[model samples]
Target: MTPTVIPIDTPGLGDRTYLAHDGAVALVVDPQRDFDRVLAAADEAGVRITHVFETHIHNDYVTGGLALAEAVGAQYLVNADDPVAFERTPVRDGDVVPVGDHMRVRVVHTPGHTHTHLSFALSADGEPVAVFTGGSLLFGSTGRPDLLGPDHTDALVHAQWHSAQRLAQELPDTTEVFPTHGFGSFCSATQSEASASTIGDEKRSNPALTQDEEAYVAELLAGLEEFPAYYAQMGPANSAGPGAPDLSDPELADPAELRRRIDAGEWVVDLRTRSAFAAGHLAGSVNFGIDGQFITYLGWILPYDATVTLLGETPEQVAQAQRDMVRIGMDPAAMATGKPEEWADGAPLGSFPVTDFAGLAQELRENPDAERVVLDVRRPAEFDSGHIAGAVNVPVHAVLAHLESIPHQQLWVHCAGGYRASVVASILAARGHDVVAIDDSYDESAGAAGLELV
Candidate 1:
């Protein structure tokens, strides 16, 4: 019988958790941040996950391999060449990892996306079946060569070329290829809408494999998009285990006790949705919505030096928030207890006033020449679709470091919805900027307010 393969999607972020099962034992691959959902899926499956493998040092989000390993008592594995500071069993090329009586995985070192990228070949009952390509090769395109150093682009191109050829020549043509990242991920230069591909199909259809090494290098080097400025900082955080919290936890603390903890230097993170957060939030708490790429934003705004206590509505939300923090190397001493309203003595972080189209129109009209800077904190694609006329694009993930460039005048920010805008508003407020967060409806009111986009 064929072994079962189960894929679990992490909510908000697009990372995946895979389980390759052979009756009693299972292997999990690339369990990055946003792990609560992944954990639940594994529990439901009732398979004993014995090994956790990381494809590479992740840049876009935190890795959940450590936490998952700890939770399930599994051995964590990464490429032998990786410089991860955490303890992990080093896997190298051709080493077989047994999953059960009839299933095994062979690690193949395929470095190009990073200095330490790995792919795994699966064999069931002594027959080769699939390869977990990780970031080395995707459905439509190869992993970006620019992730390493620009100086090593040529070498990386050659490595990747040889790597693809090796897999194509060595692994059976029938082998299914599963990659860690897909479309919308920053890791790959090009990705298909479809998630998985077969080795035979990739050999015939992948553009990167058809080009000569030099040509491939040239194509990859030309005009790669600027990565989020926050990406550079994330690698190091992942390297060092989450450091000591800059603040104390208040999860068990009552309203007064929570305030005392904050007074003693703990920072509160409001993880509610933007609409819920905007309607009412703790006055000084930064509003990073719990949904949709929350960990990436958390890494961007939450200072490594601060202790972070979460303000979440549900238990699952709270666990997710905690796991996200841990994945990115932010170990909070403790979380705050009770609801936002309960923390009476804690000072308000800042007001994230949720505005409808009309409210934004009135605000824009009232502040005609007051140096009001309208910041559109959406992705490049979203910004292209009709934004507030004159709004400068500074994606929320890249906002904190570039704050010096933002004029110190009054700032108005909006995202597709109120969520990201609130996160940006809180970030600016923390930096002492006067900011007003507008909901997605800002664009609808822009025409009525007579605001024009350039």
Candidate 2:
């Protein structure tokens, strides 16, 4: 059987890596820091990974291609234009790498997501099958052009329109499309959960394909949102050659050491549920709520490069949380597992004020002109769809930058759900603002809580 392309998802990053083989040989594309799944899958199929290819110098996670290729003795490949410390089999557009007796990999120079982006054409039995279009093209939306920094955004977006047009016009309608970023990833220009699409499907449905180039660029540029603060560090790590994947248990900290770190103002991240954390946590610790969309805010809400301590409910949980943090290039100094009451001993545990949707409604009704600022931390597009009549639309990542403009009076915070509200509440509270977190459902609160949606 011709080995079909298998998409391996990294849930924390909301990205997918692919594996394709022709029974005897395989190719790995855009792997994350963890390569266990890729390696194991190749082994199970009894195929050696002949080539490991990167779609770009990724700005989302530290890729594991170099190490994975070394382990399997496979040729690692990257675009010729991508500057990196280590050596790789540099490839350019139209270059084809033979995989087996019947399969060949064609390189397409698709530059949009980055200056040196390339998409792989996977062929079997001398027939075109699929393209691994990484960040260049996604399910519904294309990759955001601003990932390289503000300077490259304008030029990249213009290039993105051309790159997208190339794919639509050149590739056959039946060719399957696989991409690296989508499904809650900040890398995508718009919100979509579509798993995969075909050249025909995209050409007929994608706005970037149907709309004029100028209109596509305008819509694409306007839809970009604030990404994580740690994003700035990703490309550098990938360029310098990241250290070996070490998601192993960080040195376990006893209660005393954990307490000392918290007292020292180190970023002690509580990786429990929001309710568990809000009930009682260490005085100086912050709640990140590992179970819900945790990784997206990990680098944004916490201090970049600060010594971090992970407090999970168990050692296994701590290990998982550590993996999520390191995949995005955030390293923790130490980690521990237990409740704050257990670690705090006699010290007073801290709790934040939690208001339900109804409680916020009552507060607004009573205050009349109190003008309680409902700070919506969701993306601008999400806010534009429907939000509280007077809720301010500053996203979570831009909250710190917009602090000077917000009032010092009573501030109410809510996201699409309660997860982000908890994060924003902690951040605002840390900055000496009177913040109340609405911990209830956003959709439920729309009209039930006397909220007038605009």
Model 2 Cα lDDT, one tens digit per residue, 1-454:
4557888988777899999987888899998888888988888888888899999998888899898888888999999888899989999999999887778889998888998999998888777888899998788778889998899999999888888889878788888999999867788888675777898888887877888989999988877767877888889999987766877668878778877886687877888888887788776777888898777787876667789888888988788777887788777789877778886777888777888888888887888788568899897878888998888888887876887897887789898779998987776675567778888888877578887788
Q: Give the range of the ten consecutive residues with the poorest summed lDDT in model 2.
A: 424-433
Clash number by candidate, in order:
18, 0
lDDT against true structure, model 1: 0.72
Question: lDDT (CA) for every model shown?
Answer: 0.72, 0.84
Model 1 residue-pair collision total: 18
TM per prediction = 0.78, 0.92
| TM-score for candidate 1, residues paired by index | 0.78
For candidate 2, give the lDDT: 0.84
